[model samples]
Target: MGEEEQEDEMVTCKTNREKEEKEDDAIATEAAAAAPYCYPTLRFDIPPYRSYHFYQQFRNASNPNNFLKSVNWSPDGSCFLTSSEDNTLRKFNLPDCVDTTQEDTCSSSLEDPYVADLIVNEGESVYDYCWYPYMSASDPTTCVFASTTRDHPIHLWDAITGQLRGTYRAYDAMDEITAAFSTAFNPSGTKIFGGYNKSLRIFDIHRPGRDFEQYSTLQGNKEGQPGIISAIAFCPSHTGMFATGSYSQTTAIYSENNMELLYLLHGQEGGVTHVQFSKDGNFLYTGGRKDPYILCWDIRNTVSIVYKLYRSSELTNQRILFDIEPSGRHLGTGGQVCCIFC
Candidate 1:
């Protein structure tokens, strides 16, 4: 009960408080380590400068008019794949480091660090291509992409070596080869969904051959999406649902489990060319060939269009694709006018 006893009690309390603070700091560090990596938000107010650019490699002497058709980034963001008019798929790996603050400058093919690292030539023009949903550069086996080309079966190409890994063939009723207009890997990356004329085919990723389960998009009563399917996008939230855009100007949502038509979206001025689901998978955005507007629809309520995002498209038959950013707060798209809309 003296002054020394009281001072001893206060020292003990201080030590205990310091120990608890250290424990709290350790817990916070562990939690941060367990959290997934997040990409920094982009600033649009300031004009963005290009860190890398490439040209000359895409040129073809035999086909002087060859041009890039579409570019898709890998799921891991390690690289990107490009399809071109020359019936070739090229993979370009991103550099390990870049000086974003440096002034923008043009670089020739020889000087460009973003030159194509791998290229796979197809027999015909590519119709659609998509990276494996679970692709990771660290895993060699998972680094592959599926591409559909004219008059050719769906090819699973190795992203690292540019080799033909596998093929999924679909035969017509008369036992002839049938090519898919669009192809995409399911959320699990265990199956590939392919779109054909008034039909959809599901192929097992492991077993690559003519074997497939076909579903007629056009039902027996003729109450379904008609014409060739142009694009396929799966729900990002692993909801076992996907949206298909058709050349018939109809966008249809289907249940991945049974290929059941959930809803049909109509309003595209031309044939639908692209369909992407929001990161939350609650909304769907669709773009069409020669269509100036990208229609947004709420899957929860398909009765009315939620809104329309306009782009400079309407004149070209080429597919003008748009994508929702990872944060789902912004959407970016390229149009025929050579400008990107965000």
Candidate 2:
């Protein structure tokens, strides 16, 4: 064959091979893309309860006096912890009850929480309290609870025994110590986060660290009117997702791994004092000092607000308390309201 003719043939062969390769790759890509996606849908089927019919007025002795600031239930849902302006962190225990086996044999019903114990002392005004993770299976029944106070310090106490575990002094360089508003434990229970003033400081709880040996610095809003991050909560399902609310009347969903801002939730009227994720991590609830309403948002759809529970009104402000069951079935709010869903 002539040289030029052979060269042209060779080029044609190469182009055909390339075209075939491209076609094969396109087919493979489409096949992979067409694979069915599977995401577990959270079932929220339990019916809702009206504010009146759900929870009775828990006028138990352990109830915090004045403004009941924060509440946290134990891991097993056997008890609940609360901190209030009344200057105490108390533990209310579930009434003793036999397991299903014994219940079936005896034909008795399950018990409820009562004024079982006083976990913390009566002097310091506890602004927030968080139960330690993995508390149920711990060696002793003395689970840890972090109580942040206007006393310019965070006190870690044994929820069962009421013994002081450790005290984290407020950083002196920050001028006046603001009220420690919100406290939370990392999912692993190795670290604790305290929200105050303009800083969200993380501390090493297990190693017994000094005052606020902060490993991460999170500053939201800006100077002139630095937004005080009033409420902070770690995601219950995914370790990397967390939510923070501030005095600027905004809530930011951020990544815990790199602290990257994911979404900023707004439309509230006042500073957010508390933010929490539903047990399944599908929804977020936020409320605060001036906001007498609990705002619920769908995490997947950032722009959608699921519901709002009016905690107070013009005639007389009603203090609404709230809690979520571990099973994610029941949401108990203040003023005797419990919401249930599948």
Candidate 3:
């Protein structure tokens, strides 16, 4: 073919490619517009009303004092899991017709507006529990959670059927079984990170057994984060980093790739009970046992305490928990007091 003919064909091909690219962009834009992200709006000026109550569900007839210890919502927001003093983990599914905006949407006369759909009785007291990061109600295989209890191996339970899916065991140097103090799934949901006495263990989710990679939080000369690890949290941005809170009143950040200690934070008045990353993963919030303030630290600088959030938990030894909202604007905390602070 002549040179002019070849040039014309090249121009025609370029035009078609541009047209296809424009169509692809239009499709993506339309898809985004159809289901745009929505953030929740919370009002702090008015007193929050109770949307649901569950006094009857948690009450134990025999014990008469069974109460909830901690509560966590599933990753998909479809349900919530609660650990109670009765050595049981209960899963409560949110009702489809319930509306929080209305005062009397559900049965107002009922003492318990919701009941646990499933319950798993642990052999001992539950230390920590976390849902799989990728868990969804639409996917049965991904609908699972991991829990660590006293004198028991880490158990992965099916949220739908309330069955034990698998167990991840850790053995002490004496060849005896050891239980983790806290457990959490990595951001990828491919591995489970367990907190122990001055050490951390990583277990492959696909292989549930005694096999794991252990790393000591203490270095030579015994100068590192010591005491039992109380909590673990991963960065939401997938930065290959995580934070661990210890009973030694210290919180440390470590690299997920090599498990190397990155930074150690001090100034907690009591043993650190919970550590959480902000929605953007640039800051970390930590709450301690008997500590009324939740300290927020700028992970980037780590020079001094950024700010402290006050909660009514100075007199109790319970682990007061706090979490950042999805919008990263407001923070809510639970304490020993009757009221929840936001």
The number of clashing residue pairs in model 2 is: 8
TM-score of 1: 0.84
Writing each residue's lDDT as its tens digit, candidate 2 over 1-342 gives 999999999999999999999999999999988997544444456432211110112333565235555666787677777665557566777557635433232122233223448646655655567778778724554477777766656778876677778876556465644556678887888878787665677777854445564422344443222376767788889668988777877888877676667888886777776677998888998865556577899989988788887754212222334666656655655533344333
Residue 259 shift from truth in candidate 3, angstroms: 0.6
Q: Which candidate is the best by TM-score?
A: 3
Which should have the higher lDDT, number 1 or number 2?
1
**Comparison by TM-score, 1 against 2, better one:** 1
**1-342, model 1: which lDDT tens digit per residue?**
999999999999999999999999999999999998676667777765665555577775777788877889999999999888888888988878887766676542356555789989999989999999889999999999999988899999988888889999999989888899999998888999999999999999999998899999998999999999999999988888899999999999999887889999999999999999988889999999888899989999999999988888898998887777766677888885544344
lDDT of 2 at 341: 30
- The Cα local distance difference test for each model comes to 0.88, 0.66, 0.90
RMSD of 3: 4.4
Please tell me which predicted candidate would have the highest lDDT against the true structure.
3
Model 3 accuracy (lDDT, Cα): 0.90
Candidate 1: segments with Cα more than 4 A from true spot: 1-45, 60-62, 99-102, 107-110, 338-342
> Which of 2 and 3 is ahead in TM-score?
3
lDDT tens digits by residue: candidate 3, 149-172: 999999999999998999999999
Error of 2 at 220 (Å): 9.6
CA displacement after TM-score superposition, residue 171 of candidate 3 (Å): 1.5
